[model samples]
Target chain A: MDKESYIFNKFKNSLNGDDGAVVGKCVYSKDLFVEGVHFRREWMSLTQIATKSMLVNISDAIAMNAVPKYALLGVSLPKDISVGEIDELTNGFLKIAREYGVQIIGGDTISDEKIVISITIISKTKNPIYRKGASNGDLLAFTGNLGDVKKEFEILENGGKISNDSKFYIPNLKDKFFYKVAKFINAAMDISDGLSKDLSRLLKVNSLGFKPLLKLSKDELCSGEEYEILFAFKPKFKDKILKIACKTNTKITIFGQCVELDENTKFINKCKEHHF
Target chain B: MDKESYIFNKFKNSLNGDDGAVVGKCVYSKDLFVEGVHFRREWMSLTQIATKSMLVNISDAIAMNAVPKYALLGVSLPKDISVGEIDELTNGFLKIAREYGVQIIGGDTISDEKIVISITIISKTKNPIYRKGASNGDLLAFTGNLGDVKKEFEILENGGKISNDSKFYIPNLKDKFFYKVAKFINAAMDISDGLSKDLSRLLKVNSLGFKPLLKLSKDELCSGEEYEILFAFKPKFKDKILKIACKTNTKITIFGQCVELDENTKFINKCKEHHF
Candidate 1:
C-alpha cells in the first residue's frame, strides 16, 4: 500500500474515510493550499489564493449536501507580505464567506518562507452522502463541464493570458442543485483529484467498478481541481435528476454506470494520484 | 498597531478577541506549527513535534474551560519523510488524542519542503471564559510553575538534551482545576505567547492594566509556550479557588491583580511578540 493508504488504513475504524467526517448532524472538512504545490504567487493574487482556499474547503461540505457554517483558517505567510496584502487576503476570505454564509470563526497566523493556508469548514447535514453507498448498475453523473479547466491551465502555463471569467481559479459549485438531489443520490464526492482517481476511490469503497457509457476527453478524465460533484444513483432517478438540474440551471451529464468487476468490463485509470 | 492586531482589529466586531472563536456553545481554535518557525526538525523528533502540535491547540480549549471533542489536522509534509516517521507522528497524535478523548474527525495532507501542521480543535463550553471580563482589583492567578521551559528551550537550542519529563513538550494542564473554578473566574487564557504579551492583549481588550504583586524573573514572564492558564477572579473567591486547586493537586500562584491603566502602574513588555 502507498503511504497515504497505509496510514489511513491504520485509522480506518475510527475514520469515516469520506471527504468530510460526520459527527451527529455536523460534517467537518479540511483542505490545504500550499504556495508552490497548489498555486503560484505569480499566477494568482493573494486575494485569489485566499478566495480559492475557502471555496475549495466549502466544496467538500457542499458535496456532502451540507450548508457551510463556520471556518477556521491556519496561515503561514512570508515576511515580505505587506499589510495591504494581508488586508486583501482577509477581504478575499470575507467575500467568499459572505457568499456562503460561513463565519470565519478562528485561525492562526505565523511566519514562513512560503504561504500555507489550511482551512477547516464546519457544516451540518441530516443525511450525508457517502462514497460507499453505490450499488450495482447505479448510474453515475457529474455536475458542470469538465476539461475546460485543463484548457485554461495550459493557456497560463504557455505564457498566455487566461480570460478573467475563466473558471480555473474559481469553481462554480452547484450546491443548491446537489442539495435538491441529495436524497436521490446513492453515493457522491467532489472531483478534486480528477474524475478517474476520485471515481476509483468511490468504487473501491463500495467494492464495485465502473463502465463508461459516454466518451470523455483525456483532459476531462485526468486534470484535477474540478471541485464538481460526481454522484451515483439508480437509473430510475434519471428523470427526476434531469428535472432538478433543469430547474436549478445546473449542467449534469450521465457518463457512466457502476458495474461488476470483470475482464470484459472497461475501467479507466488515466488520472494522476496526488502524491504527498 | 502591530501586524497581527492591525489585521484582527479589522474583524474585531465579528470575533470575540479571545484564544478561540465562540459560536453558540462551541469554540473553535486553530494553531499553526511550521518548521523553523515553531520548531526545528533537528532539535526534536517527529513524535515530539506531533505531540506538541496537538497539545498546544488543546491548551486553548482548556483555557476556555471547554471539553475538546474533535480535531482537524492539516499536514504539509516534506518529500523525505519515511513511512516509519509518518507512523510515529500518527502515534504521537493518537497518544494525546486518547488522553483528551478527542477524535481525529478530518484533515488534509500535501507535500512541501517544510512540515506544517495546522491543527483545528472543536470544543464545547456552556460558559467560555474570556479575557475581557476581569474587573478592576480582580486577583490574577496562574497554574503550575514557570521559567523552567525557557531553560529547557535554551538547552535544546544549544545541542543539549531536554529531560523527558520537561513540560516544554507536554504541558501539564489543570483542566479539572479550571473547570472547578469556571464559575468563579472572570477572565482566563493560556500563556503561549508569554505572560507579558498575552496579558497585554487581555488588558487592552478590557481597557485595564495589571499590577504584579510578586517578583518574577524575566524568563518567567517573557519566555513563551508556557501553556499555563492565567486567570483573574474576585478576591472573595480566593479561598474557594485554593481549596479546588488543592483538591485537584494543582499549583496555583496569585502573582498580580487587575488595575486601571495609569502612568504610575507598571506594564511588562519584555515578552516576544510573534510577527507575521
Candidate 2:
C-alpha cells in the first residue's frame, strides 16, 4: 500500500472510503494543494493554482451527488507574498465558490515557507452515493475523456509550456451531469488518482473484478488529476444514462463491467501513486 | 491591519468574522498548525503535536457554543515519517476526538517537508454565540488563568524545556462552561491570538470599546494559544455567570465592560501578531 493508504488505514473504522464522507444529509471533505508537491509557482499562475485547488475539492462533493454549500479555507502563505498575489488567489477561490454557490466561511491563516491551501467543503445531498454498492455484472463507465492530463504533465515536466486553458490548471467538474445521473448510479467516485488505481479501489471494496469491454492504453489508465466521474450502474439503465448524458451534454465512455473475482480475471492498477 | 486580516478582508462579504461561521444550524471552522510556525518537533512529541492541533480547532467550536460533531483532518507529513510516528499522531487525534464525541469523517494526506495539520470542525448549535451582539456596558470576562502560554512559548524559544503538563502542549478548553452559559453570552470568541488582540476584535466588531476594570500585564494581554474563552454579557446575568463558573469549577476573571468608542477610552492591542 502507498503511504497515504497506510496512514488512512489506521482510521479505517471512521473513514467511509468514498469521495467524501457522508454524515446525515451532509458530505464533508477536505483536500490539500501544497507548493512544490502539488504544483510549482513557475508552472501555473496564482489564480490557476487556487482555482484548481477549489475545483479538485468540489469534485469530491460532486462525486458523492452532493451540492456544496459552505467552504472553510486554511491558507498558509509565505511571508513575502504580495498583496496583488493574495488578491489573485482570493479572487480565484471566490470565483469558483461563487460559480458553485458555496459560502466562504471562517478559516485560519498562518505564515509558512510556501503556499499551502487546505479547503474543507461541506455539501448536502438527499441520497448520497457510496463506493461499495456496485454489484456483480454492473456496467462500469466514466465521464469525460482521460489521458490528456498525463500528456500535459509530461510536457510541463520536460520544461515545455502548455496552453493557458490546460486541464492541469482548470479542471472541469460534471456537477450538473452528476446531479442528474446520481439516482441511476449504484457506486460513484471521482477519478483524481487516474483511472486504473481508482478503478481498482472501487472494485476491491466490493470484492469484485473487472472485465474490460473496451481497450484502454496505459496513458488513459494512469493519468492523474482527471477529476471525472467513475461510476457503476445496472445494464438495464444504459439507455437512460445515455439519454441523460445527451441532455446534459456530457461525454460518456462505457469501458468495462463489474465481475466476480476469479483467478482468470485480473484488475491490476498500473498507475503510479500521486503522493508518498 | 495585519496580513491575515488584509487577505481575509478581500472576501469580507462572505466572511462572518466569528470563531466559526454559522450556516443554518451547522457551524464550520478550519485551523492550520504548521511545524516551525506553530511548534517544533524537537520540543513536543508527535502525540502532543496532534493533540494540540485537535484541541485548537475544537476550541473554535466550543467558543461558538457549538458541540463538535465531525472533523476532517488535512495532514501533510514529512517524507521520512515512520509508521510508529503515524500511529502516535493518529492516536492523539483519536483520543481527543473520543473525548469530545466527534467523528473522524474523512481527510486528505500528502507529503511535505514538515508536518502540517489543517483540521476542519463541523459543529451543530441551535443558537450560536457570535463575535457581534455585545452592547455598551456589557461586562467582559475570560475563563482560566492567562499568561502561562506566553511564558511557556518564550521558554521553548530560548531553548528551555517545559513540563509535559504545560498549557502550550495541552490546552484546557472551557467547553462545558460555555455550553452551560451560552445563553447568557452576548458576544463570544476563544482567545487564540492572545487577550488584547482577540478582545479588541471582539469589541471592535460590535462598534464598541473597553474600560479595563483590572490592570493587565503584558504577558496576560499578549499570550497566544491560550484557547480560553473571552466573552461579553449583560450586568443582569453577571451573578448567574459567576454561579455557573463556580458550579463548573472554572476560574472567571471579569476584566472590563464594553463602552462606547471614545478618544479617551482606548482598546489598545499591545499583543504581537502571531502570523504575518
Candidate 3:
C-alpha cells in the first residue's frame, strides 16, 4: 500500500472513506488551498482567492447531498499583506458564505511566507452518497463540461488574457440538482483531481471497473480541479435523473458503466495526485 | 472594534461566539499551528510537533464540556519532508487521537514552504458552556496551575535542558471533570492566550468584571499557550464542583468572582492577540 492508504487503513473502521466524514447527521469536510501550489498571487485578487477557497470546500459537502451550514477558516498570511487586503479577503469570505447560508463561526490565523487558506465545512444530510456502493451495471455520469479548464489554464500560463468570468476561478456548482436526485444515486464523488483519478478511487473501493461509452479528450480525463460531481446510478433511473436535471437546469452527461473487473478492462492510473 | 471583532460581528447572529461552533449535539473547532509561530523546528522532533497540533485543537473541545469524537487534519509540508517523517507525524497523530478516543476521519495535504498543521476536532455535548453566561457574584476558577509554563518556556528558549515530559508540549486535560460540572458552570473558556486576556473576553461578553484573589504573578496572567480550563460558577455550586474535581483526581483553584463593571475593578488587556 502507498503511504496515504497505509495511514488511512490504520483507522479505516471509523472513517467513511468518502468525500466527507459522516458523523451522525452531519458531514464534515476539509480542503487546503496553498498560494503557489493552487493559485499564484498575480493570477487573481485576494478576494477572489478567498471566495474560491470557500467554494471548493462547500463543493465537497454539496457532493454528498448535504446542506452546507457552518465553516471554520484557517489562514496564514504573508508579512506584506495589507489591512485593506485582509478586509477584501474577509468580505470575499462573508459574501460567499452569505450566499450559501453558511456562517463563519471560528478560525485561527498566523503569519507565514505565503497565503495558506484551509477551510472546514460542516453540513447536514440524512442519506449521504458513498463511493463504494456502485453495482456492476451502474451507469457513470458527470455534471457540467470538462477540458475547458485546461484551456483557461494554458492561456494563463502563456501570459495571455483570459476572460474575467472564467469558470476556472469560480465554478458554478449544481448542488440543488444533486439534492433533487440524492436518493436515486448509488455512489458519487467530486472531480477535484480529474475524472480518471477520482473514478479510479470510486471504483477501487468496490473492486469494480469502468468502460467509457462517450469520447473524451485526454485533457478532459486527466486535468485536475474541475470541482464537478461524478456519480453513478442504476440504468433504470436514467430517465428520472434526466428529468430532474432538466427541471433543475443542470447539464449532466452519461459517460460510462461499471463492470466486473477483468484483464481486458483498461484502468487509467496516470492522473495527478494532489498531495505527494 | 478590531478587525477580528468587526469580521465576527457581521455574522454574530449566526454564531455562538464560543471556543467552538455548536451544531446540534456536536461542537466543531479548528486551530492552526504553523512552524516558527507555534514552535521552532530545532526545539522538538516531528513527533512532538504533530502531537502538539492535535492536542491544542482537542483542548478547545474539552473546554466546552464536549467529548471529542472525530478529527480532520490539513497539513502543509515543506519539500524536504521525507516519508519517514510523514510516518512519524502520522504516528504522533494516531497516538494522541487514541488517547482522546478521537478518530482520524479524513483530511487533505499539500506542499508548501513551511509545515502548517491545521486541525479540526468535532466533539459532542448536549449542553455546551458558552463564555457569555457569567453573572454577578459567580465564582471564577481554573484548572491546574499557571506560571510554571513560563519557566519551562524560558528554559527551552535559553537553550537549557528541560525534561521531555514537559506540559509545554502536551497538556493534561480533565475533560471528565468538566463534563461533571457542565450543568453547574455558568461561563468558561480555555486559557490559551493567557488568563488575563481570555478572562477579559469571557467577562466582556456579559458586561462583568473579575478581581483575582490568588495574587498571581505577571507571568501567570500573561503567558500564552497554557491550555488550562478557566471557568465560572455560582458560589452555591462551589462545593459540588470541588467534590467532583477531587473525585476525578483533578485540581481546582478558585481565584476570583464575577462582579459588576466599575472603575475600582481593573481589566487587563495585555495578553497576546494571535491574529491582529
Best by DockQ: 2
**Chain A: TM-score in each candidate?**
0.96, 0.98, 0.95
Return the TM-score for chain B, candidate 1.
0.96
Please give, for residues A74-127, the per-residue lDDT of candidate 1 as tens digits.
787887879889999989999999999987777877777888888989899999
Superposed Cα deviation of residue A249, candidate 3 (Å): 2.8
Q: For residues A1-276, what per-residue lDDT tens digits would candidate 2 score against the true structure? A: 478888778677645567899888999889999999889999998999999999999999999999998888899998899888889999999999999998887688888789999999989999999988999999999999999999999999999999989888988899888899899999989999999999999999888989999999998899999999999999999999999999999999999999999876658887677768
- Look at candidate 1 and tell me the lDDT of residue A150: 77
Q: Which ten residues in a row have the lowest lDDT in candidate 1 chain A?
A: A7-16
Off by over 4 Å in 2: none
- Please name the candidate that would achieve the greatest TM-score relative to the true structure: 2
DockQ for every prediction shown: 0.68, 0.78, 0.62
Candidate 3's docking class is medium
Candidate 2, lDDT over the whole model: 0.91
lDDT at A109 for candidate 2? 84
Taking all chains together, each candidate's TM-score versus the true structure is: 0.96, 0.98, 0.95
Q: At residue A32, what lDDT does model 2 achieve?
A: 95
Per-residue alpha-carbon lDDT of model 1 for B87-162, expressed as tens digits? 9998998899999999887687777898889998989999999888999999988899888888888899889988
Q: State the displacement of the C-alpha of residue A179, model 3, in Å, after optimal TM-score superposition.
A: 1.5
Candidates in order: C-alpha RMSD to true structure: 1.7, 1.2, 2.0
Model 1 is docked with a DockQ of: 0.68
